[model samples]
Target: MEEVKFGQDINKQKHKKMNQTVLITGASTGIGLEMAKQLAAKKFNLILVARSAEKLQEIQKHLQDQEGVTVKIFAKDLSNSANAISLYNDVKRENSKVDMLINNAGVGLYGNFTETSLDAELDMIELNISSLVALTKLFAQDMLILKSGKIMNVASLLAFLPFPYYSVYSATKAFVLAFSETLAAELEGTGVTVTTLCPGPIDTPFNTDSMLTTNAYKANKPMPASVVAESGVDLLLDGKGKKLVGFNNWFISNLPRFTPDFIMMKIKKNLASQRK
Candidate 1:
């Protein structure tokens, strides 16, 4: 596979045409919201999970009216970790099965590791790693029983190149990367596919306009949330392998292979840190 900045090769791109119900975590905002919109447009039934009940209600009504597809919204604070199983049970009670699962909820605290609040970072771990794993474990077992399903785990470019300020956040995503890739390999013959979406600095509230100061923002720029979501939804339904969004991002994910740890850290520091 050529790691070109020209974007994913059109020849290799896949977009399967199947109507499957998709449940997306963090579906009220940013990349998650964008994903919900794209999937709804494609006529897939949706199960949207987020922390905002009001926002979820609005989204449910809008998607239901506009797309004319069944939209189920669950207001869940998956940061609790234990709530992952509860949410799963809740969804199963309402709906018999989930054809696809998109684990997109995550949080990050930007600052020196020691300066950051331990409580906040711990909660982030629960949302970004623990809850994701819990849901994946639960849903994956069901998928294996049915002998068909897809799971999309959202990681980050920082997963490959750990940044200084986002130490805990990046580590969690690194865990996602390894966990997803290994799980994908494990589920190869089980008819349940696990695909990872590793997007770079996306122009979402999560990424923020403040990120313009970073070298990464200058070098790769911020891809629109819609673009990333489109790619993710397409990959999810099409049953493609892992995707790392952005042109420069694909190269960035592979840089660590050739660059020394010190040099890589310096570059990632510049990319993630404030630029003068």
Candidate 2:
């Protein structure tokens, strides 16, 4: 679907309740895509952003055809920090007012720090941290000006329980959790709220790959993306503050508080390494 021009009425569209639009990044797959589907079911217009134009278009058409809602797709590789700002500009120019922003795009590496490619880790950092910050800042400003909007930043269970093999990825998520907590407090009375979603291992495209077959990863059963997104959508729309998905995940995230750091790290390292 083409971008909505400035003069068009957002509420007068065919879908009666699709006036409020949600912008979701990494929407071609995984939690991001699942959240998009759920939001569409709730009659929210969608602005889906991802790297693959073909995939984005496919989802766009699927949603529009099935839900009778406006679906706009933007193909963007947000790993490059500048692209985040560019995306914000493009949305504004297209006259799309994002009522909610979901920073769901991220990357993870499953290998020893020394063994993993430096470039890959750098790209992961750029996508997981830099772009998230850029988009949150840009859109959060817009929301403040309007005095309305919700933002959901997807962190990981590893945000609080950083594992060894996923060093950089875990660190990036930790930043997301910390940043969202502070920002939520700052925007408390502004009417705009920020929510952090911390999911443990997810049955998303990222983990289905054979790359993460370590003993620790295999031991922990992953939650379905649909289930996690269901909680995420509700928390973002109806509730506020950080949400740790599932009881087990919440328990694991708090283990660090009870167990000493050095002992916990050793245990985490053992779990992250392959069986010898």
Candidate 3:
């Protein structure tokens, strides 16, 4: 693939349909849901994927009614690599021409690596890394053929450094960050852009899960999901390769370079200890 310069005008690309379609995984809630809402307002059709069919339908109806945009729902557990492939096949079968793909479905297991469930850690790897790669591969092919499309992969602030209790989760996000960057480079002039969003903690049900509810977790305020979603979508549309959602997150992501390894590790460990 030839290397294309960044910041080509996405609005100028011609699509099969007058209105472009954006397929977002984990669209039932949180940042993904907010992305859907923001895009709907922009008149882009949406394909919402998640594990909750009921929630997807509710969002589907709401977007359709409020924004007058077409919304399709696919409820599947993407943690399974096979299901991720199935999602791509199903979208092709439906003849949905996706102009953008958002890989946002992920889970985190917070605990000491040794104490965490190995099975759950494996599942997280599958969902956060493998499934993302699978979906990106499938859709990127179509986008290549069309010579136009966008991809946004959701990483995390944790990707920049190792977190003690979030060892596996942080590792998975690091993979996502590295993978997305390399893939973006490979697809450079292919008329397809890959953007990674590395957001800090967000106030959402995802953070409310059992592993994340400790008093230490509650002590740190989280950014609003809507804020992260808006910035992510904006950067993706702007053809940026990677974005950290907030100033503090951006600072922290870069701080590791200047800080000593031992100091960073100690700070991370101290932060991790709060989860109990």
Candidate 4:
């Protein structure tokens, strides 16, 4: 019986060693953090990237202690194209095979496009669209060589509609959705899959300062970050193409397509007005 138990322990160690490694951006908090936790529980080695080095270290230590999965942390400001490239290069330098990539780093500004700070908007674009594309291209090449990888691009339900106040953010997410879907098709049969996650307002640090005070935010209870993270990871691993979290969010995302343009615009305008 002791020998049998020892064999079982050895098998578990072997299984853990065989687990794939996933790299996640924005992994210090919110959906990214939750996704890391879930994946760690599953024994996937983790490479966590975020601007907050302290937070990343904290999480890395905790997850390593709890799940016994390897955790690597990189603090990078992906808003800069140079930094985004550096991140990919650094990962390559480590000789780590990234089995999955989560493009979750993003920012949003709330206000009229004209009134919003131009610098802030540009930074958002760099982080949301440019960085996402750069990272995808860089890692995707490696994945192609391996012929096995999964990618999850975190878009938003706002991608489907014209958001008056969140103009640039909405536009970026729209690009993500379109880019992810097209890439999924292009990569078909290549053993690499792309999944786009369009979640509604999520209760994360990302929203705490900006969106949480709005009436629209209040009207719809923000989905817990863990719930969204779990759903997204599930879809990504399943090789699903596009997923919108929450029934209401899914309905809203689809509703805009059928609604009249003017009516849709008015509704969006009203929702935007709720921001204080």
| lDDT assessment of candidate 3 | 0.87
Better of 2 and 3 by lDDT: 2
Which 10 consecutive residues of model 4 have the lowest summed lDDT?
207-216
Could you tell me which 10 consecutive residues in candidate 3 have the lowest summed lDDT? 1-10
Backbone clash tally (model 1): 0
Candidate 4 residues 1-276, lDDT tens each?
999999999998768545789999999889999999998987889999999999998999999999998899999998887899999889889898898999999988888788889999889999999999999999998999989899999999888875888999999999999999999999999999999999989888777455676666866788999999999889877848889899988888787779888998988787766555
Which candidate has the top score in lDDT?
A: 2
**Model 1 bad stretches (over 4 Å):** 1-19, 208-210
Residue lDDT tens for model 3, 204-253? 88874654555435544588889989998897778577888878778878
Candidate 2, residues 139-189, lDDT tens digits: the string is 999999999999999998999988887889999999999999999999999
RMSD of each: 7.2, 6.1, 5.5, 3.3
Reference-based TM-score of each model: 0.90, 0.92, 0.90, 0.92
Deviation in angstroms for 52 in model 1? 0.2
**Model 2 misplacement above 4 A:** 1-17, 208-211
Reference-based lDDT, each prediction: 0.88, 0.89, 0.87, 0.89
TM-score of 4: 0.92
- lDDT over C-alpha atoms for residue 185 of model 2: 98
lDDT of 4: 0.89
- Sorted on lDDT, highest at the top, how do the candidates line up? 2, 4, 1, 3
Clashing pairs in 3: none
